[model samples]
Target: MMRRWARAAVVAVALIAVSCGGSETTETTASITDPPQINRWVTVGGIEVPIGTTDGPRGGEWEPFAGFSHTPQGAALAAITQSVQLSTASDRNWPTILAGVAAPGEGRDLYAAHRGLVEISGTDPEMVPTIVGYTIADYSDTAATVDVVQRFSDDSLASSTTEVVWTDSDWRLHLPSDDTATITALDAVPSELVNLEETRK
Candidate 1:
């Protein structure tokens, strides 16, 4: 009879210990907080354009390019156009007219060639003309869209927009949505063309 009683006492003590342990675990779990969602816009080129959060029914818009000047590509294009102006009194400069007119990568080679010519000339390198007044518009986090606008010396304007996706703590270019053929095509094209073509279509 003593042996049976001892066995029962042991079982009772074991149950009490398990119940106490479980309650403590539950309390700890309830007290723990979840981590915040990752933000991606912070990482791309360390470029931080201002973004406005939506409040109630009002949406926010951002313009990143309002005051930026002197991008390498823009400067190079301006140099080329200035060179053309010096060679001939044409009313329109070639480089300025062609800015943002072709595929994104296509203009790089032409701009580089212009830079070479600017170097060959004895003009002050700084005054040799650089890109000015480039702008990024509609920068957003909730809607995920951004537009890039570049202006040239001859008053020509070129603009493009691309879809943005938040992932891994950075905003990545979202693949063109497949729900609409038009949107898919725009996404397939270079970012510069995406905005203009989509608007027209």
Candidate 2:
């Protein structure tokens, strides 16, 4: 449980850096207002926002995870788009959280066991982040992956590669084990978003 939360938090940092990190954000044709609705997510520059299943409409929290794009890539992008939103949402609004996106049967079981294991404070989130652009990083007949550039409000930038698998219901994100550990283990340096003022100085 602890490890999953750690992985989820690190994944959040990575995605946020990607969504909001770049020095200059690419103009996006995609846009949306907050509270994110139930199941709807946005995609821009081949990067789709990812949000997984909610507590369901029971609390009026979210709609069922349905209405995905029929195309495999499209469906994967859609789920990822929502995942980004969930990471940025007020932790308190989601007091109980599930760590990853997974298949219905296996996913539901995991969620049931781990639900409420994580708590988000529901604090007002920082500047809204955005998915600027992405490219298909890897692909198989049944699976697909995306490498994305994400942006934060201050124009800080980061990049991440996400994966997805097709399930009977639709596509779901394939979260890495210990996402933060995984990144650090790669022995990579963090990229700082350049400041124009600093450059000028």
Candidate 3:
């Protein structure tokens, strides 16, 4: 299920990138806005899924997968949404990853995971989980490079530099297998979080 969600996120980003014609310059210069209020809830088949919140040095944002499934698409969208929300909350600049991306509900199983991560990890600071960090390590017409820092509950920190290419219309993170392994080791993400009833539009 996680794989499926990840694939869906990849597809969504790819589709957006393609539709956008890949012409926009990759810039992290945009100023960040206030963190979005957690007033909105994702409804799937009419059921409500609870999303978690995160508390960091720069206030807090919703963690992805808080009340949603852990599918590939869900994780991907969660990451994106969390990044946007955190940037806004921190009053920092916005990242280009969300420029033309659509809202979360557009996808069913693909709920945001960052919110959940925030909520869960925030509740327990000992378990420090890293989401997306925006630092301009490299950039080009077709790609942007970033350095991400992932922290654990044991006071240990791991860093990885990844390059995201503009594919289809969205920027996608390119993680090597080793980096993937390192991330997976940090936390045991749930496989899926499905809604029992249909959500109302």
In terms of lDDT, the best-performing candidate is 2
Candidate 1 has which clashing residue pairs, if any? 40-169, 40-170, 40-171, 65-135, 65-136, 74-131, 75-130, 75-131
Candidate 1, which ten residues in sequence have the lowest lDDT sum? 18-27
Q: Compared with the true structure, what per-residue lDDT tens digits does model 3 show for residues 95-186?
A: 22223232223221122223233321112233323332223344454555443333343434333344444454444333232212212222
Of 1 and 2, the candidate ahead on lDDT is 2
Error of 3 at 61 (Å): 16
- Please provide TM-scores, in order, for all candidate models, with all chains considered together: 0.22, 0.48, 0.29
Better of 2 and 3 by lDDT: 2
Assess each prediction's global lDDT (C-alpha) against the native: 0.23, 0.38, 0.29
- Give the runs in model 2 whose Cα sits over 4 Å from its true position: 1-61, 70-73, 85-101, 104-115, 179-201
How far residue 116's Cα lies from its native spot in candidate 1, in Å, is 27
Model 3 alpha-carbon miss at residue 83, Å: 12
Off by over 4 Å in 3: 1-128, 175-201
Tens-digit lDDT track for model 1 on 7-30? 333322211111000001111121
